[model samples]
Target: MSTPPESRQEAIARLSRSASDLEARTTRQLSHEAAGQKAAGQAWKIIADLFGGVFVGLALGFGIDYFAGTTPVGIIGGVLLGFAVSVWMAWRTAQRLMAEAKQHGEPQSVPFDDDEDQGA
Candidate 1:
């Protein structure tokens, strides 16, 4: 099928509009992906922190119990202490992130690590 050619002015206008639309769409998509990635990374960090705190607490408690000759009491107390430490860590992390966001006018990412106790 043969079709009439688009006028030059019409073609130029159409191309310009398309270019603008494409730029906008690309920008939006990139931003959305960046946000998703940041969220996923943060979520993994929280999960890791939660588990790390519990395991460390348990090990410490068990060691104490073994040295002190306490059996079941040591294990139970270790688990409870681990849970409390985990909660505290989570709270601290959240507060830090919120403060950073407030200070920078944008959300900032921090690497998770075990150095949290280095200062203390």
Candidate 2:
């Protein structure tokens, strides 16, 4: 047998609850997506910094080689210097990012436990 119909007020209350739940779920999903986008943007910035460093070095080295007639040495030195600078810059950026993340109370990756590995 079918149950009795709900009252108009009960129906309205049920709809309101459903709407609230939907709103909450939508808000959570949007926030998660925004966070992912932010992370992706930061990653791209890091990659761009790395490539820009290398490109700048290469260009400077090529210019020096063209003018000074020290072809191989200039290019090689420039590339090495550029790579070193890029690495240092990347390290600094990573440190800053880590600090910001810590300050914001973001969840960090769990450190590897050697004990667990040894047991296996």
Candidate 3:
């Protein structure tokens, strides 16, 4: 037997449900894209901080070597200092990012414990 035609109310209800579902899916997709963009921005910031620190250090070191005629000594010290400063800046940025993520209720990575896996 052929099925009966859908009533007006039934059609309206179906359309409303579909709209709600579509809205929900759209919202989720948008959120995911936003999160991806945010993550990419944060990564760039970290990278800039690291590169900037090293470049500044190198420039300053070269200037010092030129003025003092110390050559390798100044350049070597400058590079070392720059690397150290860059590392510190990167570490600080990571900590701040972690704190922000925690505040936002985002999931944080936990270190895997070998002891737990051992089942002792």
Best by the lDDT measure: 3
TM-score of each: 0.64, 0.81, 0.78
lDDT per residue as tens, model 1, 43-94: 7887888898899888988998899999778878888889898988888888
Clashes of each: 0, 0, 0
Computed on alpha carbons, the lDDT of every model, listed in order, comes to: 0.81, 0.83, 0.86
lDDT of 2 by residue, 5-113 (tens): 9999999999999999889867766776787899899888888878888888888899999999999988888888888888888888889889999898956443345
Q: Stretches of candidate 3 above 4 Å error? A: 106-120
Q: After aligning candidate 3 to the native by TM-score, how far in Å is the CA of 49 from where it should be?
A: 1.6
What local lDDT does model 2 show for residue 74? 82
Cα lDDT, model 3, residue 46: 90
| lDDT string, candidate 3, 33-67, tens digits | 78779999999999998888888888989999999
Clashing pairs in 3: none
